[model samples]
Target: MRKANSYLDLVLNPFNLFRTKRILNINPTVIPQRKEPESINLYVYDYDAENIHEERLKNVKDCFTYKHSNRVTWINIDGLRRTDVEVICNHYGIHPLVQEDILSIGQRPKVDEIEGVMFCLLNMLYFNEKESAVEVEQISIVLGEQFVLSFQEDASRDVFNPLRDKIQFRQNKIRQSGTDYLFYTLIDLIVDSYFVVMERLSDKIETLEEDIVRNPNKRTLARINQLRKEMIVLKRNIAPVRDMVNGILRSESNLLEERTGKYFKDIYDHIVQANDLAENYRDMMMNLHDLYLSNVNLKMNEVMKVMAIVTCLLAPATVIGGLFGMNFDVIPYAHHRWGFYIACSLMVLIPLVMLYIFRRRGWF
Candidate 1:
């Protein structure tokens, strides 16, 4: 029972590391014929608008009628928080390891070839105003010869919306295309979003660069450091996925069809662009550090100049005060009242003369 509860938590608990709080599950089966042995079973389950466990089971059963070779069925589950995900995974012959991977949120982008299926886990990042940070989520894809399975951290909103729309419209090549094409389309959406996120990061770096150059406040430095850390995290998550996507593009698997390879190529291109942008941002961050140091040095020089002028102006006054402070009765200022006035005038006049000389000489 304890182990079972742990498993339950894995499926039902919302993982926050990636900033996502929702999940969507898609189950597609391919069938070749509707009659006879029904060689393929096609089920496109749109698990939207409903969240009940019984409803989930009923929906899965509805698609269980026939498995035929001529047809491919797709099932899409929109909410990640539902317990039905675990239930459905158990109902299918899906490996517990795959289910484990799905339940574990915040995993980096990666690819795993398990048994005969290719499991691809990807990260999608979005800037969240509420959180004031980039929110990341895991998108898991299972590729097989007959069908493909996909899972999203949140079904409520995501890059996969376009793929959902394509499925709904039934007008595009998606409906007529193979499951591999559908997979490629989904990948294309993710890669495109990566570009969008890269642009946001680049803009941030640019802003920081400007701030550091013009006004390098402590607060600005803090923000730049924070952005640098975020970029490092982003790089760690994205780099491996770039390599994995490249591998998929070059693989001979029919899982990515010949026509669909172009879509993967597009994703690869975006990954390359994103990688370049990330490196550029890192370099800019280093430059900002140097700029901050330079600003500090320039400010110190300005402060020293003001101090030097104040000291120079006070030199003559100090000398006159010392002469009057002497205990010698023979001092001129100590003897006559008019002598004190004369001494004060000399003290004032001497600083003015010195100041003029310094100004003329450009010593200041």
Candidate 2:
């Protein structure tokens, strides 16, 4: 249902998306320039709306300070606004096509290695209470020998917070390891989030299943539809990440170290688990739909039973009324003093006889 809303909003309110300003500010925390290995230079920075006032262009200069290939470099662009993104793209020697890919806000998770640098686009998502939905941003990471660069369409979330902690914490393998490990850690974090969301979805499905069995109605159908839509969106996002992880496992590129391969395998396992849960939920949804239909049929049958009983009871009454309604002067009941009493007696007895017959037949 959110996907449906997003599509409608994109078509009808495309202009408003820009007019609506983001409250979140981007303050890029760029790593201080370090001595370059004559062959490799590495640089990484994070920028968004908040810090835009003090150091927008200056951070690009910092990114350029490390320019050698022997060292890996990383640059993270947090905000997706055209002006903010274009300025850094210009400084980093990013291709027009790559810039175009970055500009596309709905870009799916993918990795493209260009020349010596590996460019990766990923979705960073978290739930927003105000919006009542998952908020997603495009994250672009550029990996070069000696450095890795990451970009975000917004600054509100620190998608790499764990990775940052790992890097800063002493004796942590991330900082002591190569850029590939840093890359794996970042992907691992995103993949880990899928489980968090899947757990929530599983709880919802369990509740819905109970509701369906107890009282399947319009509201239950609505809930099922909503869950179905959410599952679809999750599947769409998670499927590619699984394939991308598998690609990393299969690729001959040195970007994925053999030591780190096991972790990627672990991420792949999570994806498989998530996939299984999604499939189970889909089956449950179908069963619920069927259950709703069955409930409706049962209600209709009850209604028909009541109507049939009323018609059978009313048949004798109609005949008695029609007989008394005659206008002929020779009618025996019309001349009789007990006419009214006889009519009442017949009407009461007729319904009793029909009721007894119905009870014997088990029609009630």
Worst-scoring 10-residue span by lDDT in model 2: 46-55
Give each model's whole-structure lDDT: 0.65, 0.65
> What overall lDDT, based on C-alpha atoms, would model 2 receive against the true structure?
0.65
- The RMSD of every model to the true structure, in order and in angstroms, is 11.1, 9.8
* Model 2 spans with C-alpha error above 4 angstroms: 1-58, 66-74, 81-96, 127-135, 206-223, 329-339, 349-364
Model 2, residue 147: distance off in Å is 1.7
Which digits, one per residue and each the tens of the lDDT, describe model 1 over residues 1-364? 9889766754564232222222212212322121222121213633212211112333544544322434444455444433555655655556777777776655657777666667778877787654345667677777765556676655456786666555655456766677677677777787778777777777777787787778778767666666666676667667877888988877777466687878788788888888887787778778878888898788888799878887888888898888789888687658776987888888889889989998999877
Candidate 2 lDDT, tens digit per residue, 1-364? Answer: 9999877875675433332232122222433132222221222532121211112343455556555534444455555555545766666666766766666645567777666566777776565444323455567777656566676655556556776554544466654667787777777888777777777777777887788777777767766666666666666667777777777788667666788889888888987887777678678778877887887788889899999889878888788888888887787776699998998888889899989988999877
Q: Per-residue error at 174 for model 1, in Å?
A: 2.2
